[model samples]
Target: MKQKIESKIQVKWKACNHGLKPQACQHWLKIYFADKKVDELEKAISKAARDPAKYGIDQPALERRFKWTRTTMTQVVEYTLQAVVGTA
Candidate 1:
């Protein structure tokens, strides 16, 4: 399913280098690293992806904030983190 980024998140995320255009969660995530603290956002995304049910975070909210396809969103996010932090 196609998801859209929320206005609130978009405004908050616009500082990143991606220019706030439409993107998947993974793509949008790259911007975080480019403009802001990658590590901090990585942790937040990690927590959000792993056990999102327990986190009480809205998938739709994330989808809106990212416009990503749910299936690979977490995988790409984690993969990006691993690549940056170094995959062991």
Candidate 2:
């Protein structure tokens, strides 16, 4: 079930013009849930942290590579959080 939701997010992300790779989406989800203060999406966050090659980012280089604005990034995070928590 978790894998199914992850795949759904990947497909939705690809369908949109986010101009980011699947890894980037995974990274965003990780950062948002890393210190969420709630138990929501714990499994997903743990999985992301366990695989840096898949979800980790170079902090210094992200500014140059990722084009998303803070507002847009927040929106994605909120959307993902809602999807995960609301569905569960």
Candidate 3:
């Protein structure tokens, strides 16, 4: 199921006129994260946001890549989780 979703995202991404813009990326990310299997990962990420060291998450690297502070990133993760779970 995951593979099928990934393939579909990839195909749609390739066919997207806007290329890899943020909107396109976010659309795909929402679709991918909506999978039931991703629920576990989202929960782990939410926990990792609170305790990066315990989760082996490189906070600085993620901050650099996202250009967001840990707090902002945490909120983003939580929001995404809620959206995916249909609770938002």
Candidate 4:
């Protein structure tokens, strides 16, 4: 499955290299990173959610720093999780 996805991405990248599929190439690449961020956020939240961690330090810190709500953070994580895991 991983190989198949990589193969598809390689095809898209090759098209970008030829300068013919700019929009499709850019869109998939952007989605790839966005999905990656979701996995990362999930890991961070898992770590902070452990014992001796009542303070808001992980994803919450990022949320506070960025001036967003806890709801938005969870929503983004859910979106990313569905994008990555759902596709698989």
User: What is the lDDT of every predicted structure here?
Assistant: 0.49, 0.52, 0.55, 0.56
Worst 10 residues of 1 by lDDT: 1-10
Per-residue CA lDDT of model 2 for 1-88, tens digit only, reads 4355556665655644566566656654564454353334444445554564687745444443333334454565567667656533
Model 3 segments more than 4 A misplaced: 18-26, 33-88
Stretches of candidate 2 exceeding 4 Å from the true structure: 1-68
Best of the candidates, lDDT: 4
What is the clash count of model 4? 0
RMSD in angstroms, all models?
13.9, 13.6, 10.7, 7.4
Q: 63-85 in candidate 1: lDDT tens per residue?
A: 65444343345555555445434
Model 1, residue 43: C-alpha shift (Å): 3.2
Candidate order, TM-score descending = 4, 3, 1, 2
- Cα lDDT tens digits, model 4, 1-88, are 5355546555666677787467766765865565456556656655655732575467566545444434555565555455445533
In order of appearance, the predictions have TM-scores of: 0.28, 0.25, 0.29, 0.47
Model 2 local distance difference test score: 0.52
Between prediction 1 and prediction 3, the one with superior lDDT is 3
lDDT of 1 at 56: 82
The better-scoring model by TM-score among 1 and 3 is 3
